[model samples]
Target: MTLKAGSILTGTIVNITNFGAFVEVDGKTGLVHISEVADSFVKDIHDHLKEKDKVKVKVLSVDDNGKISLSIKQAIDHKKSVKPIEIDWEKKNTQNAVNFEDKLSRFLKDSEEKFQDLKRHQDSRTRGYKKNTSH
Candidate 1:
């Protein structure tokens, strides 16, 4: 079968290397780069695929030298068939309120502790002043 550009093809993993996988489709063979193994980050290609595994790949480019560049990302359907994503504004507002309240409570507690320390210092100073004045 002629592997045309932009066409998705299914092939068996014949060989695997650190850089890419060699897939064979019918009599034709192509190289699927490690970057084209998945839509997300691929730390290791072995995590998603292995030799003798069947995988779907999309042909991205065909060089004049007959080199075929393939991508697994292109094989994914990114179009959302669902309705528009509506943010839960009310829930978000309530969550924000809860977060702000927690922060405010923490701040108030810190301020109260500082105020109490300051008041204690002032009272001590007042007592000292009274003793000095009396003496």
Candidate 2:
């Protein structure tokens, strides 16, 4: 079969090196660079790959020289439909819930009471020091 870019192919590791690994696909050879061995850092290419190991690889490129570049990490499919975590903010059925409207009303009432107290204190302080009313 003809190898093409962005195509996934099954291949066997023919050789391993410190910098990369060579794979044989459809009787044609390809090189899987150490950086393409995985999505993470690869300190030693041999630790992640070995000779004669069958692996699925994604075709990165095929140059004019017919030398194919492959990626083992990109071959596997990672597309999964995932939903965000849904949270119940309020217990509508429960009687113990503090509703938004109720909370707002309570806050307004408390603010009014505090304002009245502050006004009373200011009035009391002013009462001690009377202002001249005669023009």
Candidate 3:
């Protein structure tokens, strides 16, 4: 298959370095950068990949010099997109009905209490200032 940007391809990791991994796909070698290895932070490339390991990679770009940039994380994300998300509408609606009211009530109560406390503090300060000024 012709490799192009956004193409997902299975490749063998022929070499690994501190910066990235070299993957051989369709007889062409491409670089999968460290940041593209996984969704999470990669402190060490060796922890995520090894030489000769097969991995699915997404073509990010092919420069004029024939350098291809690949991403393993994008390839994995693309595969995940194939699966449909299942939602329990009944359960979700029930939970939202109950939880939203409770959460809103609690938030309102807390806000009111804070407002009252701030008002009381300001009032006391004002009264104290008036008394000093009068004397």
Which candidate leads in lDDT?
Answer: 3
Q: Tell me each candidate's TM-score.
A: 0.57, 0.61, 0.61
lDDT of 3 by residue, 6-120 (tens): 9999999999999999999999999999999998999999999989999999999999999999999989865656687898766557777789999999999999999999999
Model 3 misplaced regions, further than 4 Å = 78-135
lDDT of 1 by residue, 6-72 (tens): 8988878888889988887756678889888877788888888889998778888778888877776
Taken over the whole model, the C-alpha lDDT of each candidate is 0.82, 0.90, 0.93
The TM-score, computed over Cα atoms with residue i paired to residue i, of candidate 2 is: 0.61
User: Model 2, 63-115: lDDT tens per residue?
Assistant: 99999999998987756433567988774655435576688899999999999
**Root mean square deviation (Cα) for candidate 1:** 6.7
- Candidate 2: residue pairs that collide: none
Q: Model 1, stretches more than 4 Å misplaced?
A: 80-135
lDDT of 1: 0.82
The candidate with the higher lDDT, 1 or 3, is 3
